[model samples]
Target: MGDTDGAEKLLEEAFYNQPFNKDIVTLVFSFYMDTADYRKLIKVAQRCMAFHLADRLCWHRLGTAHFYIGEYQSAVLAFRRSLEIEHNPKASFGLSQPLLALGLYEEGFNRFEERFVANPSINWIRAEKMHMPKWQGEPLAGKSILIWSEQGLGDSIQFSRLLAVLSAQGALVDLILHPHHSDLEGVLSTVAGINSIILIAGNRFKLQRRYDYHCPMMSLMGILKLTPAIEVANEAYISTPASHKNKWFEYQERPEKKIGIVWSTALSDAFLKEHPMHAAAKVKKSIALRQLEPLFHLSHCCFFPLQIAISEEDRQYLSKYDNICDVSEKLSTFSDTAAMIDEMDLVISIDTSVAHLAGAMGKETINLLGYVSDWRWQQNREDTPWYASMSLYQQTFEGNWEQPVNKLVRLLQ
Candidate 1:
């Protein structure tokens, strides 16, 4: 294999010789994109764009590179440029996130429809939704509406706040998410206006019967024409079952404050392989369990792992730490985890379901965010209206958790 430096030199020579060649620019784009070299990508992308101004791919590349570097405004322009060139669902989906991140919710939600067309997991669901009368902005008095979840648990939880709006309007709300979330049915039933909760795989014909309208859970925002002026109805949403209130821990009570820690997300290999960019972004969202060794040394705190389970590597690593406790054996459901989080003095989490769960439950949560995080986290803000009890600790540069970790140490001290 050629050394990276030499390979770069050869690519540069080729680009210099055939500056206008689409193939050469594409190669250059791939080289930088795979390497996560956003700055060089920006330079190469701009060079290509100036020559091939009409190229939608170049504009898309430019937008993604800008997005990676946390330049929301520039990313918006570049994605829009790509869209203006052609009707690219990829570009439209790309445009939506940064638009929302920049706090342009109305425009962002308008373009967000393209996600269902561009993303593999969501695209198929759209066809199923089309069989039902899609909810438009209409009066919901005495009407029954179905809201089906599209994404991960965290996404469902984040958007579930909007259900209260439906509740206020005298609409009967029913939910249909994945079958695996049946454990959380007890939890979802607690939401203000929800009449029933069914797993997508369970009682489908019965659940789908005679609805006035049905909507993708995320589309509720767009349907509501959600904007900054419209305050999101966030009152009395998710809560844990009262039966799970009893705390169970091996160690006896100590003066040390109990902290729940979730450092990473659990994702399927197939999903990661299918969405490489999402996989890369997911990589940025987590802290290596090894990287959290310093926090484990805090004698004043006894840490508990709230993630579904620890990896074998992390499990072995935990053998060396006494303050951090393993209690995953008791956590069999989201409801179980919610009960435990209710007992904690605080919860520290990365961009994972636990973060959303803790935030939704109104627990004191310190959410750790990467430089470029989920659109919901947005950019440059310590507080989110989505969760009143959550405080954000964001990385100053991509993949560097040192500054945020140091700040967290101070906060805990």
Candidate 2:
């Protein structure tokens, strides 16, 4: 059915004949990585490593395979072995995830920064080529700094705590965004002590205020040796505008538990085009609206849609269920979304920005995690240090939402 009919067979034959050959094994590894067949990769890698114990690339791929499949300890072992062979950026980057998942943030945060060198397509690296002076441990008082968001909207919102601490130190901090991220300005602009918010799309008008320092928002954690905390320094840093909160005041008839639901991730098309595998991963994380019919049947819990850019199929699915209100249309900005979250008695979301937003606001939230969630969620724990108001529900089985959904239903009951 596809153009590469004979390729898989030829590669399989080559790999079978020359199992310990680095070049052949690498080609096979790339084939599996492209296909996202991690289990098969593990088998092949383990066999390769049995003979070629010193192969760092083989150990790295083995560790990555274990990481993808939720075996954090095994991954840690493999990654450590790879690092022992050679202190490469790819091994360091691969090692960081499992360590963070295991709640060892200090080392994880330090090593995670190597991802830029391991995979250079990161947007932050592109920003650095323009010669933005990074802030080390310099004095913040009476200094002006520009902190820009690195990865996704969720990450920007989650790590905005650093901005608050900088402001508290009287650094005269300002938040900067990419040109396309102007919509986020509405949410971040309201955070206390931000001097100004600028969107740098080669706009000379916005760049009029010269900054003394420029740093990626996520980098502050490593640079400052900070860990994720909710109560002490990082308590509810995101501020919802009173006006925006007032707009959602009309929906506050909470006789039953008012629950807001987010089933899909809202990623930019540009980002999706750049990372096709992540676009595919979106399907793994998203739950079909129809599949959540059981949750809708719960009469005591009123559900509201927290997702923007609703797909036609999801829209049709929403139409079939009267309980799932289509309030997503009213959420023009993240501030509106934040205010809407304030109205909810409980928020249930798959790991997305809405979940992070709810957590940032200190709203009671249930985060539905995949079998192996992002390192931020950590592992084997219901509670996260990043969000005291949030509780995690992890999938016991891979590629299945039934377990987490059932848990939510039980929690609602």
- TM-score list, all predictions: 0.90, 0.90
* Candidate 2 minimal-lDDT segment of 10 residues: 200-209
Clashes of 1: 0
Local lDDT at 53 for model 2: 46
Candidate lDDT scores, in order, read 0.80, 0.80
Q: Which lDDT tens digits does candidate 2 get at residues 1-413?
A: 46444777788899888876778888988878766678989988877757764488888998988988789999999999999988999899889999988878788888888877888866532555445577876888999998877777888888877787788777998887765556778778767778888776543333566677888787788777777753336457676876686678777875767899998887767887777667656866777776678798898878999988788888887887666778889988888888898889889999998898898888899988888788888778898888888999888887788888887778777
How far does residue 13 in candidate 2 sit from its true spot (Å)? 3.1
